[model samples]
Target: MSYTSFREPEASPPPSRPGLLRRLARDRRSMAASVAAVVIVVAAAVVYLADAATKPEVSNAANALVDTPPSAAQAEALGASPSASVSASVTPSAAATASAATAPKIPRTGWVPVDNTAWKAQVSAYNALKVDPVPAGVGNLPEFRADCQYSHSLPDDPIVAPGLPGASHMHSFVGNKAVDANTVAEDLTKFTATSCKPVQDHSAYWVPTLYDNATGKPVETTGFRVYYRSHMSNSTGQMPMPNGLRMITGDAKKKKPTPRGATGQFYCAFYGPGDLDGIARSTNGNWPICGGDATLHFMMQFPDCWDGKHLDSPNHKDHVAYGAGNTCPRSHPVKIPAITFDIRYGAKGTPAGYYLSSDKEGKSASSMHGDAFVMWDVDTMNKRTKNCVLQRRTCDNYGYQK
Candidate 1:
């Protein structure tokens, strides 16, 4: 009866179930552990991002970016032409840049050589021309003359000391009026204003200024006759004087004493009852004093042969040479018109005499020198050389053989 009444001992009270507060405490501890794990993961991610931002990017050999020029399509997408993109990306090598910097620059203006194809063609054409035969009794002088007056005075010599103003002795210039220390071949060709009679002759001529010893004044030339002639008897294959041909006659540095009959001495020019060496002698025994209506005159002859290579040379005279007998020297094979300067002064000469600007110490006429810078119309020069020189006839200022 007692066993029946019992409720199976209440199933042992469900094994003493836990309280609500204890359960809550255990759940809070588990939640705190999970939150700490999440915080640690977030901190590790933040540190990785910060290190990536601060560190410099280094190139790995296998993954290095190539700086190649953009393709045409890529350049177009970037709003640039392909050529511009390529030029912008490329750079000159250091060696090329250094070579350009160290290379000698060719001068634009100066005594440049005449070695162009056009000039060579001109030489060939000149050589191929037919020489006209000389008629009988044509005076036998293959020559022409340029009558020039005094142009201006300057202490400048374009041939001797180019671009250096006042570097030369005082020179009385004739022919081309625009001649100066800075004068070039182009200048003479362009500036056609000349003191010479033939307007086509744009050449320049200069000589040292003659100074009177007593008055200490410069004596300018009254007349300057430039004779272009050939000294050879057989005047065949004479070429026209090249434009920009420059040469000097006589030695300005010759300080030797020039007596009355000395070579290259200045003498008198008279007609009747007078000597070519003048009547009296100067104090230096160089200059001559005329007795009659004679005045001081000097003749300077330049070489007739050219080297046909340079427009000018170092000494200015080595490029030219006087022809021997009837033929030019092998070194200077081109037969050009020889230039002769017949300069006349108004003074009759005195005992004190005169001194050339080039000869201050020597006070002699032996130092007298003349410089010629030739320029002319190509047609005129050719015509004169053909008609007057090759034909062996004397031509006047108009280049006509009468």
Candidate 2:
């Protein structure tokens, strides 16, 4: 976690003190030379100070959390004026701001801190009834799996601050042993282990849960399964997720919304995974819901397309992009593995019922948001992505040895 230190060479014996030179019986001209040496040193000091003043502070991009304001299109339907100015501020200091272009370091926290207060509100145009088709031959393909535990007591949610319950919204988490709104890459990677399938991937994954606002009790994803694989047709293999990759989808501000672009899928089960006929329901294509005899199902999909440069973005979702119809674009050519969530929560009510922190009313899925914190063992990701996904082999526990 600590950067290697470089020991400086001993300072040149202080320019050989003039007093010592006197003992050598130096001439008067030699004394003038000594004075000249002192003058040179003073001049050098002045120059160093002036240069330092002009140069920007070495912004330890590690701690920089920058954000810009939302765009006009984002505020169009959100009741805010499109012309509203966004505060492109980086917290921690303001005099010498952190460069928006600098990629932050994520070695310790497994998550890069970000500020999305001003990101362009992703419009409904982002998703036009687009549904990532199910991976048809899951059993025959190599897949990375994570068996995340279901927790009613909040697991550490890395995006939302800890203990300050009503600030943003409520969420449940799985994977990293150490996670919280302020969590960093180190927190997860340095932990003893994780609660997910790839124990080595110590990152946290979370989603907002529906609760009965009246009761103030939380629902559950009692059992969670995360499957990661190549989501592109032409890609032979996938790239490992960079540490500190933070992303969000779905609008947490829309009082009533539907699932469009974000990986917000809900349905009912009838003895199988993809059986959604009479039971599948959603509000205007926003939040989908399915209620059955046993439980309610939630499925989410992350973009397999990546820009290949950033681990985190100002808005969190900008760095990575979604593939078009399961084919990655040249712009986001690197095919990082895509993950799908198969979540089930116990239910006892009608199909149209669920709760979100954004709107206690739970009437609209518009306020829903899903946060993802990505971190993993470099070796593990490389092996699985190359061997299972690229090779088109179905595997459990990686399906092959390194």
Candidate 3:
């Protein structure tokens, strides 16, 4: 399988690392294009086809996918093998965006709606432990980096709205090409060019594409990177990501900086060191544009603990919970690998900010929502990730035959 290394077509060399202030004011734009997501073993590419504005009614047959979250039985089934699909019975709803008069604090914990409250005490204990992953943006650490550009828009969201069509907000997929609403854990094991490095990790990762509500057009997600090796690298023991492990962080309903979703966050990236400045929002947490050499960046950390019994939760995210002070909660005592996404977009300034697919502002990143639908072959994960992340090796170029 061939993976596409991130580089713009005949693009200028990456600009020299500029000042944080300059980067914040005029962060450079990435060389981007449209694509179509296809599962090709060779480069297993996602062909670019920027259709964020298209909203094609490919089929009017009441899409069983992209329609709603899962039911109790359905969640239980998928926890085993992400092959089940959400029914068209449920509808998606986010709280209305608050007025823009003030920027609210990001909530302490994420806005997790739970069907099983059993983890509450665990969460409290977990929170009480105060063992959080090393704080983000600690650029001083020896960070592992693997950069790859995006292939295209994936209207097929296999994780959130699987097996059915149009049941999910469109996503920008990477790694596996065959992933659609119907993709399963078995499908991920087959060889394919993944967008992630160390190619061996044929795991798929994606987020809702950002859109400019002003123009109703898609914003270039460009290519992003995978960062590993944090300050806690040596202390934490890791395990492979179980198949069908699904999670969602951040609220799509928040248009501004509201603590309603704290575990999920939205902040800015300056080229230099300074406190992350707050951006204006539209009630649903849509950030205003950067005024300096700043760029918009998103960070999402997955739960480090698992219950060892369930793979998914009825609420789609309540099954796995965050570790307390870096240690897995007793309820979720099984310590798996901790995954965090540090995504930076090449954009700057306030006139036209961003929104995501399900944003309340109509196809904007304004009400940015993030979802992670993972499917990895347990065996492949044992080596591709467990060995490297657990052993504290900053590995890249995955899948290259030894």
Q: Please give the clash total of every predicted structure, in order.
A: 0, 28, 61
Off by over 4 Å in 1: 1-111, 121-138
Clashes of 3: 61
Error of 1 at 37 (Å): 75
- lDDT by residue (192-218, candidate 1, tens digit) is 899998898999999999999988899
Tens-digit lDDT track of model 2 for 113-180? 22222211221222122322234455556566767885333533445443233444567777775665
Model 3: per-residue Cα lDDT at residue 282: 40
Backbone clashes (count) for model 1: 0
Q: Candidate 2 at residue 233, lDDT?
A: 55
Candidate lDDT scores, in order, read: 0.73, 0.52, 0.47
- Using all chains and alpha carbons, the TM-scores for the candidates as numbered come to 0.70, 0.58, 0.55
Off by over 4 Å in 2: 1-138, 151-157, 160-166, 257-265, 272-292, 325-327, 397-402
lDDT of 3 at 184: 53
Q: Of the candidates numbered 1 and 3, which has the greater TM-score value?
A: 1
What's the lDDT of the predicted structure labeled candidate 2?
Answer: 0.52
TM-score of 2: 0.58
Candidate 3, residues 251-360, lDDT tens digits: the string is 65555443313434446677776335344444344454444566767776666655544545545555566655545444454455666677877755344555677653
Cα-based lDDT at residue 387, candidate 2: 56
Judging by lDDT, tell me the better candidate of 1 and 2: 1
